[model samples]
Target: EPEVTQTPSHQVTQMGQEVILRCVPISNHLYFYWYRQILGQKVEFLVSFYNNEISEKSEIFDDQFSVERPDGSNFTLKIRSTKLEDSAMYFCASTGTGSPEAFFGQGTRLTVV
Candidate 1:
Protein backbone atom coordinates (compact mmCIF):
# COMPACT_ATOMS: atom_id res chain seq x y z
CA GLU A 1 0.00 0.00 0.00
CA PRO A 2 1.15 3.52 -0.76
CA GLU A 3 1.77 5.94 2.10
CA VAL A 4 2.66 9.54 2.77
CA THR A 5 6.37 10.20 3.19
CA GLN A 6 8.01 13.18 4.94
CA THR A 7 11.54 14.45 4.62
CA PRO A 8 13.83 15.18 7.58
CA SER A 9 12.39 13.13 10.41
CA HIS A 10 13.55 15.91 12.72
CA GLN A 11 14.44 19.59 12.49
CA VAL A 12 15.60 22.30 14.86
CA THR A 13 15.31 26.00 14.18
CA GLN A 14 15.63 29.30 15.97
CA MET A 15 12.59 31.10 17.29
CA GLY A 16 12.53 33.65 14.50
CA GLN A 17 13.64 31.43 11.66
CA GLU A 18 11.68 29.75 8.93
CA VAL A 19 11.29 26.08 8.03
CA ILE A 20 9.71 24.05 5.28
CA LEU A 21 8.40 20.60 6.03
CA ARG A 22 7.99 18.45 2.94
CA CYS A 23 5.74 15.53 2.22
CA VAL A 24 4.75 13.20 -0.59
CA PRO A 25 1.29 11.80 -0.18
CA ILE A 26 -0.15 8.63 -1.70
CA SER A 27 -0.21 8.94 -5.47
CA ASN A 28 -3.93 8.18 -5.73
CA HIS A 29 -5.12 10.36 -2.87
CA LEU A 30 -6.67 13.73 -3.57
CA TYR A 31 -7.24 15.40 -0.25
CA PHE A 32 -4.14 16.40 1.67
CA TYR A 33 -3.90 17.76 5.19
CA TRP A 34 -1.43 19.10 7.75
CA TYR A 35 -1.80 18.29 11.42
CA ARG A 36 0.37 18.96 14.43
CA GLN A 37 0.75 17.44 17.88
CA ILE A 38 2.29 19.73 20.48
CA LEU A 39 4.04 17.25 22.71
CA GLY A 40 1.35 15.33 24.59
CA GLN A 41 -1.56 17.36 23.26
CA LYS A 42 -4.18 16.13 20.85
CA VAL A 43 -3.51 16.27 17.13
CA GLU A 44 -4.74 19.61 15.83
CA PHE A 45 -5.70 20.34 12.26
CA LEU A 46 -3.86 23.10 10.51
CA VAL A 47 -5.09 23.08 6.95
CA SER A 48 -6.56 20.98 4.17
CA PHE A 49 -5.99 21.25 0.44
CA TYR A 50 -7.86 19.98 -2.60
CA ASN A 51 -7.94 20.93 -6.27
CA ASN A 52 -4.88 23.05 -5.62
CA GLU A 53 -6.68 25.35 -3.20
CA ILE A 54 -7.23 25.46 0.53
CA SER A 55 -10.51 23.73 1.26
CA GLU A 56 -10.46 24.30 4.99
CA LYS A 57 -8.21 25.66 7.70
CA SER A 58 -8.22 25.97 11.45
CA GLU A 59 -7.51 29.08 13.48
CA ILE A 60 -4.15 27.60 14.28
CA PHE A 61 -3.32 28.02 10.61
CA ASP A 62 -2.54 31.67 10.85
CA ASP A 63 -0.65 33.80 8.36
CA GLN A 64 2.52 32.21 9.67
CA PHE A 65 1.60 28.88 8.12
CA SER A 66 1.22 28.02 4.47
CA VAL A 67 0.76 24.94 2.29
CA GLU A 68 1.40 24.24 -1.35
CA ARG A 69 1.34 21.48 -3.90
CA PRO A 70 4.42 22.92 -5.57
CA ASP A 71 4.29 19.91 -7.92
CA GLY A 72 2.14 17.00 -8.94
CA SER A 73 3.35 14.61 -6.25
CA ASN A 74 4.72 16.75 -3.47
CA PHE A 75 2.88 18.75 -0.84
CA THR A 76 4.67 21.06 1.55
CA LEU A 77 4.08 23.05 4.72
CA LYS A 78 6.05 26.19 5.46
CA ILE A 79 6.16 28.06 8.74
CA ARG A 80 7.55 31.58 8.80
CA SER A 81 9.04 33.26 11.85
CA THR A 82 8.76 30.21 14.01
CA LYS A 83 8.00 30.51 17.70
CA LEU A 84 9.04 28.30 20.61
CA GLU A 85 5.44 27.28 21.00
CA ASP A 86 5.50 25.99 17.44
CA SER A 87 7.60 23.04 18.44
CA ALA A 88 5.68 19.89 17.65
CA MET A 89 5.40 16.81 15.46
CA TYR A 90 3.90 17.78 12.17
CA PHE A 91 2.04 15.05 10.30
CA CYS A 92 1.11 14.91 6.65
CA ALA A 93 -2.01 12.98 5.77
CA SER A 94 -4.13 12.11 2.76
CA THR A 95 -7.29 10.27 1.83
CA GLY A 96 -8.77 9.08 -1.44
CA THR A 97 -11.80 10.74 -3.02
CA GLY A 98 -14.27 8.42 -1.40
CA SER A 99 -12.47 7.55 1.79
CA PRO A 100 -12.86 9.11 5.19
CA GLU A 101 -9.80 7.45 6.71
CA ALA A 102 -6.49 9.19 6.09
CA PHE A 103 -3.02 7.69 5.97
CA PHE A 104 -0.41 9.74 7.82
CA GLY A 105 3.27 10.22 7.28
CA GLN A 106 5.83 9.36 9.96
CA GLY A 107 5.94 13.07 10.85
CA THR A 108 8.58 15.77 10.99
CA ARG A 109 9.50 16.78 14.51
CA LEU A 110 10.01 20.54 14.52
CA THR A 111 11.79 21.89 17.55
CA VAL A 112 11.77 25.67 17.75
CA VAL A 113 14.20 27.09 20.20
Candidate 2:
Protein backbone atom coordinates (compact mmCIF):
# COMPACT_ATOMS: atom_id res chain seq x y z
CA GLU A 1 0.00 0.00 0.00
CA PRO A 2 1.13 3.55 -0.74
CA GLU A 3 1.22 6.27 1.86
CA VAL A 4 2.00 9.93 2.38
CA THR A 5 5.51 10.84 3.50
CA GLN A 6 6.63 14.00 5.29
CA THR A 7 10.23 14.98 5.83
CA PRO A 8 12.02 16.10 8.98
CA SER A 9 9.65 14.34 11.38
CA HIS A 10 10.66 16.91 13.95
CA GLN A 11 11.53 20.59 13.61
CA VAL A 12 12.33 23.61 15.75
CA THR A 13 11.78 27.19 14.66
CA GLN A 14 12.27 30.66 16.07
CA MET A 15 9.28 32.75 17.07
CA GLY A 16 9.90 35.21 14.24
CA GLN A 17 11.23 32.98 11.51
CA GLU A 18 9.87 31.15 8.50
CA VAL A 19 9.44 27.46 7.89
CA ILE A 20 8.54 25.17 5.04
CA LEU A 21 7.08 21.71 5.63
CA ARG A 22 7.36 19.16 2.87
CA CYS A 23 5.32 16.12 1.85
CA VAL A 24 5.03 13.55 -0.90
CA PRO A 25 1.74 11.72 -1.39
CA ILE A 26 1.09 8.31 -2.85
CA SER A 27 1.61 8.35 -6.61
CA ASN A 28 -1.96 7.35 -7.47
CA HIS A 29 -3.66 9.76 -5.12
CA LEU A 30 -5.86 12.49 -6.54
CA TYR A 31 -6.33 14.93 -3.67
CA PHE A 32 -3.95 16.34 -1.07
CA TYR A 33 -4.41 18.26 2.16
CA TRP A 34 -2.66 19.64 5.23
CA TYR A 35 -3.90 19.30 8.78
CA ARG A 36 -2.41 20.32 12.12
CA GLN A 37 -2.79 19.29 15.72
CA ILE A 38 -1.77 21.72 18.42
CA LEU A 39 -0.44 19.46 21.10
CA GLY A 40 -3.45 17.76 22.70
CA GLN A 41 -6.02 19.61 20.64
CA LYS A 42 -8.23 18.24 17.92
CA VAL A 43 -6.84 18.04 14.39
CA GLU A 44 -7.59 21.07 12.20
CA PHE A 45 -7.66 21.36 8.49
CA LEU A 46 -5.53 24.00 6.86
CA VAL A 47 -5.78 23.70 3.12
CA SER A 48 -6.47 21.43 0.21
CA PHE A 49 -4.72 21.43 -3.16
CA TYR A 50 -5.91 19.75 -6.34
CA ASN A 51 -5.34 19.90 -10.07
CA ASN A 52 -2.42 22.27 -9.45
CA GLU A 53 -4.42 24.85 -7.51
CA ILE A 54 -5.94 25.42 -4.12
CA SER A 55 -9.41 23.94 -3.87
CA GLU A 56 -10.39 24.82 -0.35
CA LYS A 57 -8.84 26.45 2.70
CA SER A 58 -9.90 26.90 6.27
CA GLU A 59 -10.00 30.27 8.06
CA ILE A 60 -6.74 29.39 9.75
CA PHE A 61 -5.00 29.49 6.43
CA ASP A 62 -4.32 33.20 6.68
CA ASP A 63 -2.08 35.38 4.56
CA GLN A 64 0.93 34.27 6.54
CA PHE A 65 0.46 30.74 5.29
CA SER A 66 1.03 29.48 1.79
CA VAL A 67 1.36 26.15 -0.03
CA GLU A 68 2.92 24.97 -3.23
CA ARG A 69 3.77 22.06 -5.46
CA PRO A 70 6.97 23.74 -6.68
CA ASP A 71 7.97 20.40 -8.11
CA GLY A 72 5.51 18.10 -9.78
CA SER A 73 6.01 15.47 -7.13
CA ASN A 74 6.16 17.31 -3.81
CA PHE A 75 3.75 19.51 -1.89
CA THR A 76 4.92 22.09 0.63
CA LEU A 77 3.49 24.40 3.25
CA LYS A 78 5.27 27.61 4.16
CA ILE A 79 4.66 29.75 7.17
CA ARG A 80 6.01 33.26 6.73
CA SER A 81 6.62 34.10 10.37
CA THR A 82 6.42 31.55 13.13
CA LYS A 83 4.98 32.28 16.54
CA LEU A 84 5.11 30.32 19.76
CA GLU A 85 1.41 29.60 19.20
CA ASP A 86 2.23 28.16 15.80
CA SER A 87 3.82 25.10 17.22
CA ALA A 88 1.97 21.98 16.18
CA MET A 89 2.23 18.58 14.54
CA TYR A 90 1.55 18.97 10.85
CA PHE A 91 0.15 16.06 8.87
CA CYS A 92 -0.03 15.48 5.16
CA ALA A 93 -2.88 13.36 3.79
CA SER A 94 -4.22 12.12 0.49
CA THR A 95 -6.95 9.99 -1.06
CA GLY A 96 -7.72 8.48 -4.39
CA THR A 97 -10.57 9.75 -6.59
CA GLY A 98 -13.15 7.41 -5.17
CA SER A 99 -11.63 6.62 -1.82
CA PRO A 100 -13.49 7.76 1.26
CA GLU A 101 -10.57 7.60 3.61
CA ALA A 102 -7.41 9.70 3.62
CA PHE A 103 -4.05 8.20 4.42
CA PHE A 104 -1.92 10.43 6.65
CA GLY A 105 1.77 10.86 7.16
CA GLN A 106 3.35 10.28 10.55
CA GLY A 107 3.36 14.05 11.07
CA THR A 108 6.06 16.68 11.45
CA ARG A 109 6.22 18.08 14.95
CA LEU A 110 7.04 21.79 14.98
CA THR A 111 8.21 23.66 18.02
CA VAL A 112 8.62 27.41 18.09
CA VAL A 113 10.88 28.95 20.68
Candidate 3:
Protein backbone atom coordinates (compact mmCIF):
# COMPACT_ATOMS: atom_id res chain seq x y z
CA GLU A 1 0.00 0.00 0.00
CA PRO A 2 1.15 3.56 -0.67
CA GLU A 3 1.71 5.99 2.16
CA VAL A 4 2.63 9.61 2.66
CA THR A 5 6.34 10.34 2.62
CA GLN A 6 8.09 13.39 4.07
CA THR A 7 11.64 14.51 3.45
CA PRO A 8 14.34 15.72 5.83
CA SER A 9 12.94 14.12 8.97
CA HIS A 10 14.26 16.98 11.05
CA GLN A 11 15.14 20.61 10.44
CA VAL A 12 16.67 23.44 12.43
CA THR A 13 16.22 27.08 11.56
CA GLN A 14 16.66 30.58 12.89
CA MET A 15 13.81 32.65 14.26
CA GLY A 16 13.28 34.65 11.10
CA GLN A 17 14.17 32.03 8.53
CA GLU A 18 11.83 30.56 5.99
CA VAL A 19 11.34 26.81 5.87
CA ILE A 20 9.70 24.52 3.37
CA LEU A 21 8.55 21.06 4.41
CA ARG A 22 7.83 18.59 1.67
CA CYS A 23 5.57 15.57 1.44
CA VAL A 24 4.58 13.09 -1.23
CA PRO A 25 1.13 11.81 -0.43
CA ILE A 26 -0.56 8.61 -1.54
CA SER A 27 -0.88 8.73 -5.31
CA ASN A 28 -4.60 8.02 -5.43
CA HIS A 29 -5.62 10.22 -2.53
CA LEU A 30 -7.63 13.35 -3.27
CA TYR A 31 -7.53 15.03 0.11
CA PHE A 32 -4.23 16.30 1.46
CA TYR A 33 -3.69 17.86 4.86
CA TRP A 34 -1.03 19.37 7.03
CA TYR A 35 -1.16 18.95 10.77
CA ARG A 36 1.23 19.69 13.61
CA GLN A 37 1.94 18.49 17.13
CA ILE A 38 3.91 20.44 19.71
CA LEU A 39 6.22 18.11 21.62
CA GLY A 40 3.66 17.02 24.17
CA GLN A 41 0.45 18.51 22.94
CA LYS A 42 -2.52 17.26 20.98
CA VAL A 43 -2.37 17.08 17.22
CA GLU A 44 -3.74 20.19 15.56
CA PHE A 45 -5.08 20.56 12.06
CA LEU A 46 -3.60 23.35 10.00
CA VAL A 47 -5.10 23.05 6.55
CA SER A 48 -6.62 20.66 4.05
CA PHE A 49 -6.11 20.87 0.31
CA TYR A 50 -8.21 19.34 -2.44
CA ASN A 51 -8.53 19.73 -6.18
CA ASN A 52 -5.53 22.06 -6.25
CA GLU A 53 -6.96 24.49 -3.70
CA ILE A 54 -7.48 24.82 0.00
CA SER A 55 -10.64 23.02 1.02
CA GLU A 56 -10.56 24.02 4.68
CA LYS A 57 -8.21 25.60 7.16
CA SER A 58 -7.87 26.18 10.87
CA GLU A 59 -6.96 29.41 12.60
CA ILE A 60 -3.43 28.15 13.02
CA PHE A 61 -3.00 28.61 9.29
CA ASP A 62 -2.19 32.29 9.08
CA ASP A 63 -0.54 34.63 6.63
CA GLN A 64 2.83 33.24 7.53
CA PHE A 65 1.87 29.75 6.41
CA SER A 66 1.20 28.65 2.87
CA VAL A 67 0.74 25.30 1.14
CA GLU A 68 0.82 24.21 -2.47
CA ARG A 69 1.02 21.26 -4.78
CA PRO A 70 3.72 22.47 -7.14
CA ASP A 71 3.45 19.14 -8.92
CA GLY A 72 0.72 16.54 -9.07
CA SER A 73 2.62 14.31 -6.71
CA ASN A 74 4.17 16.61 -4.16
CA PHE A 75 2.63 18.85 -1.54
CA THR A 76 4.66 21.46 0.28
CA LEU A 77 4.20 23.72 3.26
CA LYS A 78 6.17 26.93 3.46
CA ILE A 79 6.52 28.94 6.59
CA ARG A 80 7.46 32.50 5.66
CA SER A 81 9.05 33.38 8.97
CA THR A 82 9.88 31.02 11.76
CA LYS A 83 9.09 31.51 15.45
CA LEU A 84 9.96 29.42 18.46
CA GLU A 85 6.36 28.36 18.82
CA ASP A 86 6.36 27.12 15.25
CA SER A 87 8.60 24.28 16.25
CA ALA A 88 6.68 21.04 16.07
CA MET A 89 6.31 17.74 14.29
CA TYR A 90 4.57 18.55 11.01
CA PHE A 91 2.59 15.67 9.55
CA CYS A 92 1.53 15.24 5.95
CA ALA A 93 -1.65 13.25 5.44
CA SER A 94 -4.02 12.10 2.73
CA THR A 95 -7.27 10.20 2.23
CA GLY A 96 -8.54 8.53 -0.91
CA THR A 97 -12.30 8.77 -0.32
CA GLY A 98 -12.76 11.32 2.45
CA SER A 99 -13.14 8.42 4.81
CA PRO A 100 -12.41 8.62 8.50
CA GLU A 101 -8.97 7.14 7.94
CA ALA A 102 -6.10 9.31 6.81
CA PHE A 103 -2.63 8.05 5.96
CA PHE A 104 0.16 10.09 7.54
CA GLY A 105 3.87 10.46 7.10
CA GLN A 106 6.41 10.08 9.85
CA GLY A 107 6.55 13.86 10.15
CA THR A 108 9.24 16.49 9.78
CA ARG A 109 10.31 17.90 13.09
CA LEU A 110 11.09 21.61 12.96
CA THR A 111 13.12 23.41 15.58
CA VAL A 112 13.37 27.19 15.60
CA VAL A 113 15.93 28.67 17.91
Q: Across residues 1-113, which tens digit of lDDT does each residue of candidate 2 receive?
A: 67789998999999989999999998888789999999989999999999988999999999989999887779999999998999999999988898769999999999999
Question: Candidate 1: RMSD over Cα atoms?
Answer: 0.6
The TM-score between candidate 2 and the true structure equals: 0.96
Alpha-carbon lDDT of model 2:
0.93
Poorest lDDT segment (10 consecutive residues) of candidate 1: 1-10
lDDT of 1 by residue, 1-113 (tens): 78899988999999999999999999999999999999989999999999999999999999999999999999999998999999999999999988799999999999998
**TM, every model:** 0.98, 0.96, 0.97
lDDT of 3 by residue, 1-113 (tens): 78899987999999999999999999989999999999999999999999999999999999999999999899999999999999999999999885769999999999999
What TM-score, to 2 decimals, does candidate 3 have? 0.97
Cα lDDT for residue 64, candidate 1: 96
Which 10-residue window of candidate 3 scores lowest in summed lDDT? 94-103
Candidate with the greatest TM-score versus the true structure: 1
Pairwise lDDT winner, candidates 2 and 3: 3
lDDT of each: 0.96, 0.93, 0.96
